[model samples]
Target: MIEKKITLVPIGDIDDSLLEYISQSIKTTFNLNTHLIPCQDLIGCVPEPVFGGRYNSTTLLKQFHECLPGKIFKLVAITDLDLYSPIFSCFFGEAQLGGCCALISLHRLGQEYYGLVEDKALFLSRCEKEVIHEISHLFGLLHCSDNNCIMYPSNNIIDTDVKSSSFCPSCNSLIERALV
Candidate 1:
């Protein structure tokens, strides 16, 4: 059997610290070996921004799916660019349900994006939540009804803030089974 592991791909100039934090967070959260590959260029892969300089997340996710490495059990690409889908104005991240690829954007996670003073702790917390949420989808988990669960959908930053970084009991059980 192929060893299950997660590979984080930095799709542009994301901070080294943020990438490291994400790698460690995924490792701890999923109990999976996680590592980061060298930075990748998404310039030609993604099309031009359509809605208010935000790239279509579905398109990006498709690109990720096409290029995902066979040996990597899961792959999460981190980008600083803004992302949006046809169904939503913008989103923190997107993933292929039951697939190996996921994508996240750090653009709106930072407080400075809302014109507030930068809070490193808050930003990092949001990052972790969003990353974990997307990765959960890769494990065939759907959005949870529990508002406080990490699997609960985040309509806005406030929703994300209100939710816990960990899954609810039901989701926890589901993920445990999926991991096995």
Candidate 2:
């Protein structure tokens, strides 16, 4: 498999602190070099309005491809803007299953979204789980059966909480073999 640098593309007013935290987590989780590129610099990838106050992730993915760096650097877009796919009611994120270029949204990850007290700790935890999950897909790892695994599919914030930020042993082996 061709391994590449991971790039985090910031979209739509994402906080710098959170992006920094995500960058650190990406390094720690994948043991790979990561870079950041502000979406303000990427032309033609502007967010498009869609149904129910959501942005289309599929379109954003296409934009990611348009500016895809040479040699498959495995770019993932990070945004606070709410995202939705045609197939789902909404998405915390969407990624190519074993392909390059993924996206994640911080919209529904916060307690504030559910009309509860804001919690940075909880928000950050959920964010890391998501970043790891999408990046795992970029690495060609499938949804894991083990609920505790980071690769396990999460349908909602609760499921994201239930899964550990670390990949399970099975996934660890796969990542090692796949990336190392």
Candidate 3:
């Protein structure tokens, strides 16, 4: 497998520190080169959440193709205007251009209920987990049963926080196999 880079497309005005943490986490964990492609227009492309916005993997990928060739494995992360389940929290898809992927963030990633202050560190951790979760999907890994693994689907913020930012042994083994 030719080690490919994961390119991040920043959709809106996401915090700079959050973006830095995300890029660094992926690179450090996977040893994959990562890049951030800034485009203010991405905000217009970002749709409202499913309950509140109409965005899907297909539409988002196409918009990215117009701006980037897909072979490089691109990923887009957007800090949306509203919060939703982690089901709608992140998305990734193969680009028609080549061995590429695109992803978007629905919200900043945290428990925002009950007036609890947003924990920047937790948000960073969630973002790291989600980014790896989606990127692993591109490499053909499924949701794992391990609750502490990043590949586990997070139905709520509690699940999100409970999950670790790295995959469990089984999932990690699968990733190695797929990369082989």
Candidate 4:
């Protein structure tokens, strides 16, 4: 099997278990060697939701690029923002790069959003789905019409809760093909 290295760069302090689940999911699903790196610049990006927030993902990614030369990585910025605020989760989409690089956000992964479901199992499942969905975009998979699929567009917490943690058959096939 052709091995790919997937890196997760944290934008801020987040649950370590969530990070571990991400690494495991990437390895099992995509057969990749995944690494999680905590970036101080990313962590310091916590900005107030009102007015212009300090979190600028594009700027952060550009800064990360300077540190790792020619190393393709996925920088995920996780924050405990009240995503339900009139202010939407400015969480950006995954960007496809030449050397397998991209970025994702964990705005909706907050516990209280899902009815304060602080259970780590539930949190990890939600996190894995979001991370997988974003990573799939880097491989050219668009949003899926299946509501039960992870690739489905989740405009709110209800949508995310309704979706399953696993990809549907079609999406699974697409990912398998990409790996090949």
The TM-score leader among the candidates is: 1
Best by lDDT: 1
Candidate 1 structure quality by residue, lDDT tens digits, 73-117: 888888888988886544899988999888889999999999999
lDDT of 3: 0.63
lDDT of 2 by residue, 1-180 (tens): 656678888877888899889888988877787778767656465566787888888888878777765566688888888888886444798888778889999999999999999999999999999999988888899989999999888888888999999979999999888886
Model 2: how far residue 167 lies from native, Å: 1.4
What are the clashing pairs of model 4? Answer: 11-42
**Error in Å for residue 148 of model 2:** 1.0
lDDT of 3 by residue, 99-120 (tens): 3554646453654633678776
Prediction 1 TM-score vs. true: 0.93
Task: Give the winner by lDDT: 1 or 4.
Answer: 1
Candidate 3 pairs with clashing backbones: 48-53, 49-53, 76-103, 78-105
Q: What C-alpha lDDT values do all the predictions have?
A: 0.86, 0.84, 0.63, 0.62
What stretches of model 3 exceed 4 Å from their correct place?
A: 1-3, 40-54, 65-67, 81-99, 106-108
Task: Point out the worst 10-residue segment of candidate 2 by lDDT.
Answer: 39-48
Q: Count the backbone clashes (under 3 Å) in each candidate.
A: 0, 0, 4, 1
All candidates' TM-scores? 0.93, 0.91, 0.75, 0.72
lDDT at 56 for candidate 4?
A: 48
- What's model 3's lDDT at 119? 77
